[model samples]
Each structure stands twice: as C-alpha cells, then as structure tokens.
Target: IKDFLIKNKITFIEDETNNNEKFTRNRIRKNIIPVLNASIAGGLGKFKRFFENTDSVLMLFDFLIEDRLNIMKSKNPIILDISKILYYNNKLRKNLLYYILSKNLFVDSSLIESIDRVISSKRPNIIFKEKGMIIEKSYNDLKIEREAGDEFDKEDFLKPGMETLFNGYTLKITKTVFIESLLKKKNVFVFPLSAGRRFKIRTLQTSDSFVPFGMNKEKKVSRFLMDNKISLSERRRVPLILNEKDEILAVGSLRRTGLYRMKKQKGCLCIYVGKN
Candidate 1:
C-alpha cells in the first residue's frame, strides 16, 4: 500500500483494525452482531451506500477521532465527571459512553449512574466532552482564573540586592536564605531577576479586583482583562520588591504593608527592578 501510494503520487490513509482476540471480543459485543442483524433487514446496505456517498465526511470524522485520541494519550489518562449526562439527549449520551468504552478509557460507571439519577430527579449540571472523556458539572459557583507568566524556572523569587532581617540582624542576599524568608509570607512577590526581562505588574490606575488564589477574591485588573479578552502585552505593570524579612514586600501595585518601613530601618535597602 505504501509503495503503491508513493508510485502513483496518491495519498491514502490506512486504518489498521486489530485482529487480536481482545479486539474481536469488543467488535462482537459492541458492533458486529448488531450490524449483522441490521444487514438482514437491509439497514446495513443503506448504511454502506450512505458511507460511500459521504466518503469525505467519514474521512473528516476519522481524522478528528484520531487527533482526539492522540491528545488523550499524550495528556493524562481520560477522566470523566458524571454530572454532565443530563445535558445531552439519550442517543448522544449513549454514543459518547460507548465510544469511551470502545476506546478502553477508564470511567466510573457508578458516577454515570449517579449523574443519571440526579437528572432523573430533576437536577442538571454542566457538561464537558473531550476525546474519550465526559464530565458533569460538580460545583455551581466555581470560578476559573488564568495568569500569564514565564513557566516557573528555578524559583527566582529572590534576586540580588534583596534584603532580609532575621532575629534583628540584617542578612545579605543568598539563594538559600532568600527562599527560606519567602516561606513565612502568605503572599510573596516573585520576579525573574535577569536584566531586561519584563515582570507583569498590576497598578491601581489600571487594575481591577479579581482574586486568583483567595477564598472571596477581588481584583479589577483580572475582571477587565477577562471582560475584553485583553492580551498580556496590554496589561498594567507593577514594581517587584524583596523585603528585609526575606518576604516579597510588594508585588507591583500594592506595597507589602510594612516592607518600606523595614527597608528604612535596616539601612541596607537594595532594590532589583526588572523591566517587563
């Protein structure tokens, strides 16, 4: 087949169906017997003609299925939440479930049953479908937030010239000591120390309340960005500071409440500011 395609300058995709016993069992259980019955009733002949007329459509479906399967394998194993079954019609839901089973994707049958029960009782939830996956909405008020930053590389939270005060003694910048200091603060400033690299800063003038990590968050910057789908380049910038207590004093828009005061007390204030 490969040689024929190459010699004729023809492009064709080959689907190799496994002939192993395990796959045979699956075919028998899911498709073969049903198809045989339909064939006796002339349904299979109609289906064959339909597929012949829709060759391009079938090709597209095959490509989509292959792409989705590749993605599923590359990522973690398929996982589904049962909460979404209510959103799809019965036929679609069953087809989706059958696809997962045919692909050998792991799913909690109990969860699917539970979801059906909930829907039967007049409750419906969000639905998500991807690859051999299906999930139901589990939480009603869940909020999702996103941030743009360099992938965490070597924890560059503390850089040169940042000061830290420990037990009344001011300590100079050292990698070990810097990391130790950050462990104490609930919120710490993080910035890449390499020169010319830009660190994102949020300012009062341009920032909005959207808390990415707190219980009930507030941040206007995030809200504005989301409302307009703002790109990262247009976001506001802020200052990055390291404190005498080995903490991130201020992220950019807001000062760590006592960071400036501690810097003055130590008389060894060294600031390393990055541009982005």
Candidate 2:
C-alpha cells in the first residue's frame, strides 16, 4: 500500500505515533513485521489477509443480528424481550449488547451475570446497572433506561380517578368494577383522598407495618418489600398510602391494608390503582 501510494503521487502525512515503541501497534510494525519478512510462513500479506477475513465474518454477524433483533422504544425503559436476547450464546450476547449500546458507553461484565441469574431463576423485577443505566428484568421483558436525572415526586396523594406522574410511570387511581376481576383484584383498596391531610401517599418508612388485606398478621414494610423481590432502588420509590394516624393502607403494587377492602360489603367505594 505504501509503494502504491508513492507511485500514484497520493500525498499523505505519516502519524509519527506509529514509531512510538510504547504503543502495541507501533511495536508490531517496527519489530514483528520486520521479523516476519525473513520467515517463510509469516509475512505482512498473510496478516492483512487474515484481518480481511475477520472483517468479512464480522459483517456477516452484523447482518444476522439485524434480522433477528429489534428494540421497542415506546416503553419508558426501551424493552428487549428475553426470547430475542437469549437466542444468542454467551459470545453473541456480548456482541449484541455492544452493538445495541454502541461503543460510546461501557457495559460492565456484571450485566451478563444479571441476565444469567434472571434466566436461571425466572425471577421478576431483577435490577442491574449497565454503563450507569438501569437494566431491569421482569420475567421475559428486559427494560433498559438511563438513570433519572431529576427526583420523582417526593409525595403524591390523589383521589380515585386522579393521576400523578411520578418517576418514570404515571400512577392513577380509578373507581371501577374491580379491573382485575372482582375475585382477583388483590392490590385494590379504598382510601378516601377527601380526608385531605388525614390521607396521604408517601415513601415507606423502616418502622411501617400493616396487616395486608385479608391477612391477620401485620408485616414490616421492609420485610414485605424484600419478600416481594422489589429491588432496593425501586423500594425507595414505592409509595405507602397512609391514614392520619399513620396506618399503612397500600404499599404500591404490593398488598394494601384490609381496613377498606370490599369483602362482602354490598355498597362501598373501591379503588383500583393502574400504572403505565
């Protein structure tokens, strides 16, 4: 290539860094390539050919990846289904993530461990950090998003049918005919927001305890959250619906206080929490 450039009168400046022995490529060019010229099996032409083949192979892998994968961006943390992610083996999984995240960001090795743990255990809401971004595993869904730069609403207390935008989701309470079916609306509970300061929704405290709806024993908020597999990062954001007397009503996406459950009551207000 150097001879060809000279013959064609194509002017080019040399990067003097190539002569620096401290750099790997510079040492390779100065020592290894010169030694290869005296050997029968090793030479610059052979090494260049090998790299050409490697480039071709990488191009083919790129095409295969484009065909098998697609990312869903409509969700807050863009979601990548586990079926697509796990389709590749360990090596290809690394390649796919590198491609998806691009070269600018650096993904930690722990990400592969996170994926393997989720796949093997089949646990939901598994959270891990990748390049300062949060990657969440919820069953078959893999959610990837950057860390929130701003704080989530510190406190949100809303009436039934009212919605509050918090963190990355919109939490809305609605009065409905048990959206999850009357028999299965486990987390739904009635809490009158008209009580004003008497009723509030805030983050759970360490000492918080409540008899989850239908259960006789009161459980500590921390124990309940841990048993639910809620990640530490998310537990901090979990809202606790409370009464003026500091009674726990609901623990957001977990269980709620039984004080307001419909049970066999004929005509009582029921609240359903929906997030999207």
Candidate 3:
C-alpha cells in the first residue's frame, strides 16, 4: 500500500503523536517490537498472521453470542445461565465479561477475580463493588448494575406467560407442560399448581420464611440468605416473589419456597433468572 502510494505520488500526512514514546502504544512499538523482531524468528509476521485469522475468530464469537440470545426465554435484563458461561475457558470468560459490561464507560480487568470467586462459590448475592458498579451472582446469572442515585425500591406484578425486569434481574414466569418425576424443589415447577397463578415481586420482608422442597420446614429469609453468603447490604436489596395469598414462593433467584411436592402434574412454571 505504501509502495503504491509512493509510485502514484499520493500525498499523506503522518500523525505526529504516533512517534511520541510518551504514549504506551508508541513506547511499545519503539522499545518492545524491535527487540522481538530482532530476537525471534517471524515475530513481526506472527502478529500480522494472527490478525489475518481474526475474522474467523470474530465470526465464531458472534455465533456463540447469538446462540445464547436465541435461547433466552425472557429479556430486559437479559439474564444468562451461569453454567453456560463457566463452561468456557478463562479467555472466553474474560471476553464474555467484557461483552456483559460493554455498556459501561470502561471495563475494569480487576473484575475478573471477583466474578470468578462469585461464580465458583455456593454463595449468592455477593456484590463486587466498584466505582458506581455493583456485580453479583443472582442465582446462576451474573448480574451487573451501576449504583443508583436513589434507593432501588420498586414492585411489579407478574402473571403467567409474562416476563419483566426487577431490581437488576430479568424475571420470566413461563407455564409449560409439567411432568412430575417426584424430584423436589427444581427450578422448573408447576404453575398455579406449584407457584400459583399470579406473583408480586418486591423487596425482601422481615417475616418471610422459605420452605425448602420436600423438607416441609420454613427458614427465615434473612438467615437463609446469610447462610448462602449474601452480604448484609445485598440482602436488603434482594427481591422476594410472593404469591397472591402473600406467601413466599421465591427469594428472588436465591431460593424457591418449595412447600408443595408434585406427584403428577399436567403443566409446569419455569422461572428463568438472569442479570441486566
């Protein structure tokens, strides 16, 4: 390209700043690239060759993202299953994390450590607090959000077949054909038959007691969350899903109130959880 330009007498301007070593890119090019070029065979060519294959890599990346988006049953916060992300290697995890926080002014690499810790642990709602940023695992979905100017206090009504976003989660309540296998407290449950017809999603309540499936016992919501490693600050913000009769069905992605056990069922209610 430069030879063609010179032969055609095409005038071009050089960026003066490109020559200044004060900039990191210029410093690296002048100091590091020359050393690599001299010490290693095909050092310069290797860099160029990698980029030549970038198109194919980028296409694969796009396909993975598209596939995840397609399987999403609900939106708004666009929650994704944690297992789907953790399934990838570290490099892929970093890329996915960057993609998740792409909307922020800048994505900090330090977040990777906190994110990895949260994903691996049995804990829930452990916030990775940064400047104007709050990242936490809501159930299986990695949730990210900017610190709000005001308190996050809001409520919404959830009906079967409808999905909505609440307190940094994309809540999806879907009714599907239920098949009872005698397994208890599964994420997918029978609606109306299991969770009832309507749900009211709001902030956590002091009186809440969530029953673990088939255990037939009630535990304090705060204690349950604390035992799950939910921080005091996050526990207050955690939303609770209440049935029409004001019974706790779920403590907002942390756990479901699994009181009723199904022996045989016709349909199921699926609550797909994810981060915004």
Candidate 4:
C-alpha cells in the first residue's frame, strides 16, 4: 500500500485520533500494556505514569531546540559589560577591548557606540553603561601634563677636530687607539651620521652586541638589523662590521654594546663626545 501510494504520488495524513482510542484501551481496560500498566491495575495510575514519561522526553527535546535558537540569535554568547568611564579614560581598556573583539566575542553595536561616546565626551567625568558593565570616568584620574620651558642645548661632540669627508659629514678622532689608527689610514674611516629616525648611537667600538629590541638576545650586527626594525633606507646608508668572532663591531647611530660597557668602566679605547 505504501509503495502504491508513493508511485501514484498520493499525499495522505495519518489520523492520530483513530489510534488514540486503541492506545488508551490497551493500557486502561486490558491492563496488559507494557511497563506503565504492568504492575498497576487502575487505568489512572498507568495513564499518569505514561503521560509523565512522555512529557519528560518532549520537555527535553523542546529545551534542546530552544537552546539552539538562542545560540543562533545571540551575538555574544558570553556578554561582557565594561564601565563607560573605565573604557574611555584608560588606553589599557581600549587595548583589552580590541583584544577581546579580535578573539571573536559577540560584541553588539551599542557597546561600540557607548565606547565612542564616552571617549569623545567633553567632560572627563562622564559615566555610561554598556552591555552589563557600567563605565564611569574619574576626573581626578586624568593624566597630568608637565609645562615645557627652558630647553637645554644638546652638546654636539662630532664637530671639532673632525675632517669633513662628505657634505654635512665629519669624522671625529675617537679615543679608541685602534679606531684612531684605523681612521688615520686611507681605507679605514668613520662618518658621524644619524642612525635610523628612532635611534641614535652614543658610542662606537670594535666589538658590540645588540638584542635588536624585539629579538630574544643580542645578535651580530647583520643579524640584528635583519631581525629588528632597521629600515631599508637606514640599512643602505649605515655602515656595520663584524669582529673575528662574528660579533657586531659597530653600527651607525647605535652605540656598540662592548664600547658602551667599556666607557662605563673608564677603560681604554673609549670615546667621549664634546660640544662642537
């Protein structure tokens, strides 16, 4: 019959009401139904037990569907609330928020707007709420600024006693006897030049090591530059050499580590800068 219906494309709906009578009679009148009726003679007890079990199963199914629907609708399953003042007044808060959002948190548009409003408010003592967190800015916590006044001139030591090799360039006589000897030679040379925009060399020496700011440990001149923040422009203009042990001996605009240490110890072969 099922095959025949399918072949004919017959659409039919089963009438559960017809089966309901048979099902109830089997449990109540006959008292021969399974588990719910096996030990109970009265129909009420068996029916009640059957209804309870059925309800429990249906309840579980409903709960699962509801949970799935909720998950689908929620932007952030684990909602977070931050105080408006805290969010706007502290850079750390902004960084933390960016980190959390980057981690795929379900952040809402309101939360973002609230953060912006707090940040842009004219008064420092602004307060607002976002998500479940309350943010309040404390006026007292505002960063204090120092007044800029008399500016002391930085003594330029690379001026006197140095011969001009290139335009705006000079080679000062270093206290290092070996460097002085090298400088005196036609091939060996020194050019007082700036390092990259962010750095300046206070000393130069025959042997030095630099950790390259972000790298693990001090590396050779070439390795440090390759690993660190050296720009192509600076690298092209800068001069660096390695010692026999493959250690970085000198880097333009950055004091050689060995030379800096030696200068601190008041050792030989140290150079000090004086005003031009």
Compare the candidates by lDDT and give the number of the best one: 3
TM agreement with the true structure for every prediction: 0.19, 0.38, 0.42, 0.21
lDDT tens readout by residue for model 2, 1-276? 879899999998888886776565675466445645444145556656645765444554443444323433333435666766665456656656655543212345666555455644556668876544677778777776665645654564555434454554445554333223544555455543332233456776778888887788888988989998999998888877766677776788667776654444433334444454
Report the alpha-carbon TM-score of model 2 versus the true structure. 0.38
What overall lDDT goes with each candidate model? 0.36, 0.59, 0.63, 0.37
Candidate 1 per-residue lDDT over residues 53-150, each given as its tens digit: 55443443444334422312211233343434333455555555444432332234654454344334433455544322344443431111112234
Tens-digit lDDT track of model 4 for 160-235: 1222111122223332223334334433323222221111222223244554433456765655665658775444
Model 2 clash pairs are: none
RMSD of each: 21.2, 20.5, 16.7, 27.3
Rank by lDDT, descending? 3, 2, 4, 1
Using TM-score, give the best candidate's number. 3
Q: What lDDT tens digits, residue by residue, belong to model 3 across residues 211-259?
A: 8545578888888888899998888777787788888877766666666
Ranking by TM-score: 3, 2, 4, 1
The per-residue C-alpha lDDT of model 2 at residue 148 equals 60
lDDT of model 2 at position 115:
49
lDDT for residue 105 in candidate 3, whole number 0-100: 23
